[model samples]
Target: MILPIVAYGAQILRAEAKDITPDYPDLKELLESMWETMYYSQGVGIAAPQVNKPIRIFLVDTAQVFERMDDEEKEEYDDDPGIKRVFINAHVQSLDGDEWAYNEGCLSIPKIREDVLRPEEITLSYVDENFEPHTETFSGLTARVIQHEYDHIDGKLFIDYLKPLRRKLLKAKLDDISKGKVSVDYKMTFPK
Candidate 1:
């Protein structure tokens, strides 16, 4: 099933998500649905909060980004292109390295893209779907994707990093998203 993504102004998107155990209700089913929804929405990552579930869970598939990049473009990145993984109860322990800006967009806040600055490296701890815990560091585009989705679970949006003036400039479009006035190929639940 493809879950309807929660749009801007949705309270769930603003609320911090709680961690869940392997015993979470229908955990496998929800993961399947989230993956389906992410692909259908053409998103590289999706958080549980985006699906109206206030849980610390997200999926990242940077292979999609790498596949879309041409050879020349791909060379700019590190040797590791991307990784497909599930993060549950993820927490970023450290963020280091130089900062860089990337064009970022969100499925919940459709039709809006902004250049957001983020650290180049991240060290985090999270568990897999089966409840196996792992602490790992990520770099490059994969790190960026993980940070973006991790923000969703922490009640933060990429737009929140925009300058005050820039965010104000986007107010109208943001309002349109909350009111369900924007057009997107994927299904969304608007707050208004």
Candidate 2:
């Protein structure tokens, strides 16, 4: 099922998500729905908050990004191979390396993209869909995607990183999104 993404100004998007236990109701089903929603929305990542669920869970699939890259660029990401994974109760243990700017967007904040600077690498600890614990490091575009989704679970948005003036410039557009005034291909639950 494709869940209606919670749009900007939804209180759920601003609230910190809670961790879910292994026995959480319909865990597998929810993950499946989230993946369907993400793919349907053409998003590389999606967090629980985006779907009006205040849980520390997010999904990432970089295959589409990989598919768009040329041979030379693909070589740098050979190890990733665009694997999809579920992250539950994730925490970024550390962020290292120089910060780089990337154009970032969110399914919740549809049609809005901005250059956001983030660390080049991240060390993250989280439980997988099956509740297995793992700690790993990620770099490049993968890391950037993870960081973006991670912010969602933490009640942060990419636009929050922008300069005050830049954000001010986008106020009207953001307001339009909140009020369901913007056009989006995917279904969204806008704030009242």
RMSD of 1: 0.9
CA deviation > 4 Å runs, candidate 1:
none
Please state the error at residue 122 of candidate 2 in Å: 0.8
lDDT of predicted model 1: 0.94
The candidate that wins on TM-score is 1
**Pairs clashing within candidate 1:** none
Q: Candidate 1 has what TM-score?
A: 0.98
lDDT of 1 by residue, 36-104 (tens): 999999999999999999999999999888988999998877735799999999999999999999999
Q: Looking at model 1, how many pairs of residues clash?
A: 0
Instruction: Supply candidate 1's per-residue lDDT for 123.
Output: 93
Residue-by-residue lDDT tens digits, candidate 2, 142-164: 88899999999999999999999
Residue pairs in collision within model 2:
none
